[model samples]
Target: MNEQTVTRDERAGEEAADPNRLLPDEDPSSHDPDDARHWLEVYDELLDFKRKMLTIAEEALDGMRDKPARREVVDTDRRVLRAECDRFEKRLAFWRNRLAAARDGKGP
Candidate 1:
């Protein structure tokens, strides 16, 4: 092929081999606003659940505190409830982190 023809072919090949040109990337944060909003809502719901669990745990402990005679039973129930509350609180924290990551355009 002539030098001009070879150059044109090489340019065409380079364009075809361009990865970004072939597969464009859409910003995760820009793909869907509704998706981000949905995640935020999920995080909020988890926070609400965590709050309710803590309240329940506090009530259980308060009840146990008032009754020394039934310490074993009350304490056991309180312990179980407190553990559950902790788990829910952790979940809330995780969701909050995920929401933050999404906002910052990072991984969830």
Candidate 2:
């Protein structure tokens, strides 16, 4: 949800109109992994939080990027952070996918 917008105009839709926004995607009466029904919501939040944090970090590093004194350091840090962010996104996506599959009637 960390869009490339210059500002945080899109509040990530964090505050759901429906308390249990994912409730529609889930069926509590089902004897499936409804117990793990919260997994998707949790994962989505985690990813959003992480993305926000990374955006802050990237912005900080970018501010340093223009300073000759910090260029070298920030350059390296930015690269490392981007790589780590990619890995983190992939890792979270895996679990999110599984949860989605389960919610959609596929096996967890």
The C-alpha TM-scores of every prediction are 0.41, 0.41
Q: What lDDT score belongs to each candidate, Candidate 1 first?
A: 0.53, 0.52
Cα lDDT of model 2 overall? 0.52
Per-prediction CA RMSD (Å):
23.4, 11.0
lDDT digits (tens) for residues 1-108 of candidate 2: 455662453433332222333333544334345445464455466557657766776667655645774675555545544554454455445556665667787873
lDDT of 1 by residue, 33-93 (tens): 4554554465457547756765775666665555764586455545544554454455445
Top candidate when judged by TM-score against the true structure? 2
What's the true lDDT of residue 96 in model 2?
Answer: 62
Model 1, runs deviating above 4 Å: 1-69
| Model 2 lowest lDDT segment of ten | 12-21
Which clashing pairs does model 1 show? Answer: none
